[model samples]
Target: MALVPASARTWLWHEHAAVPLTDAPPVVTHLAWPPHSRSRPLAALVRTAARLAAPDTAPTP
Candidate 1:
């Protein structure tokens, strides 16, 4: 299974909204990862989950 959900792509898109990620609305983002990604750390994942779960406004970029 993908390490992160398909929606996880939105976090990255919010980071780079200046350019369009796809030719569509709702601003969807898609990503692919290895079955086992060693580069990502557990702590980072936890932090990212917390941020994503918490309420926030759209990115200002």
Candidate 2:
């Protein structure tokens, strides 16, 4: 009844066995923030998340 990432299956196995939903549509995740915010910590977190999400084209190693 829930959709979870495959990577989390093992950790959640004890709670409930995961059944692959072969026909399920791919999940899309998104992030949002106030356009004019200038919080340094939030900016860093957003940058880190973007880098992790798209590693192949990340500017730095």
Candidate 3:
């Protein structure tokens, strides 16, 4: 995968996602935010790495 810097076109590559390790139904295990977002741009970038890595069949939040 390529490292995308801009937010606008970055999401376009997100049209697809990585596969999951399990076949279980998708679920939200947890959600979190950095302290005032001191590091990353969004929670989805860090918190939902697993979800994003897998197929995007699950409904969007």
Candidate 4:
């Protein structure tokens, strides 16, 4: 039984046959990367993660 964000419940349930603990406390997540890294793919991934973490701050078309 792992603790994960509610947003991941569906994917984890479908992909890993995992079940949620209804009484579990919420989890806080953080992302980190090298401050001087120059990987384009990693940058893109960080951007995507930021968007998902805070949809309200994501730019709209």
Candidate 5:
């Protein structure tokens, strides 16, 4: 299953999920960030990686 952070929900919901996977569609899990989060950018990057890693998905800018 692919895990995406909540900050990336907008892009993921609109663009990421349409791409097909080699296997089954991964169950997307949404992760939350705490207030004054230092990990927000990291979370977004991870989410981008998850999307890019899908066999049929294009690399997101």
Candidate 6:
């Protein structure tokens, strides 16, 4: 498990070449929950897992 500070969310995508990190491309499927909420971290993990599961499908935007 990892902790992602809200401010560093954008940086995570840029620094990690392997992960799908793009605000415009909608890397995550569903992100209705507030980012500061506890569930936001889970959502991030889900997106990360999805990216890792299928790297080819994720666009590098």
Which one wins on lDDT? Answer: 2
User: Per-residue CA lDDT of candidate 2, range 1-61, in tens?
Assistant: 8887888887885769788879978765676889999999998987897777766655553
Q: How many clashing residue pairs, candidate 3?
A: 0
In Å, residue 46's CA in model 5 sits off its true spot by 0.2
- Tell me the tens digit of each residue's lDDT in model 4 across 4-28: 6667766664547556578766665
- Summed over model 2, clashes come to 0
Runs with alpha carbons beyond 4 Å of true place in candidate 1: 1-24, 41-50, 53-61
Give the root-mean-square deviation of each candidate in angstroms. Answer: 12.9, 3.1, 11.3, 5.0, 14.3, 14.1
lDDT of 6 at 15: 44
lDDT of each: 0.49, 0.78, 0.53, 0.70, 0.61, 0.56
Write one digit per residue (lDDT tens) for candidate 6, span 1-61: 3544455666665545333345644334543555667776676876776676567766453
In what order do the candidates fall by TM-score, top score first? Answer: 2, 4, 5, 6, 1, 3
- Candidate 5, residues 1-43, lDDT tens digits: the string is 5755545556764546643345656565454557677786777
Q: Model 5, 52: alpha-carbon shift in Å?
A: 0.3
Cα lDDT tens digits, model 1, 13-51, are 554433434544553433345767665575466456556
Off by over 4 Å in 6: 1-38, 55-61
For candidate 3, give the lDDT of residue 32.
Answer: 62
Model 1 scores what on Cα lDDT?
Answer: 0.49
TM-score: model 5 vs. ground truth: 0.27
lDDT of 3 by residue, 14-40 (tens): 675544335455445455665677665
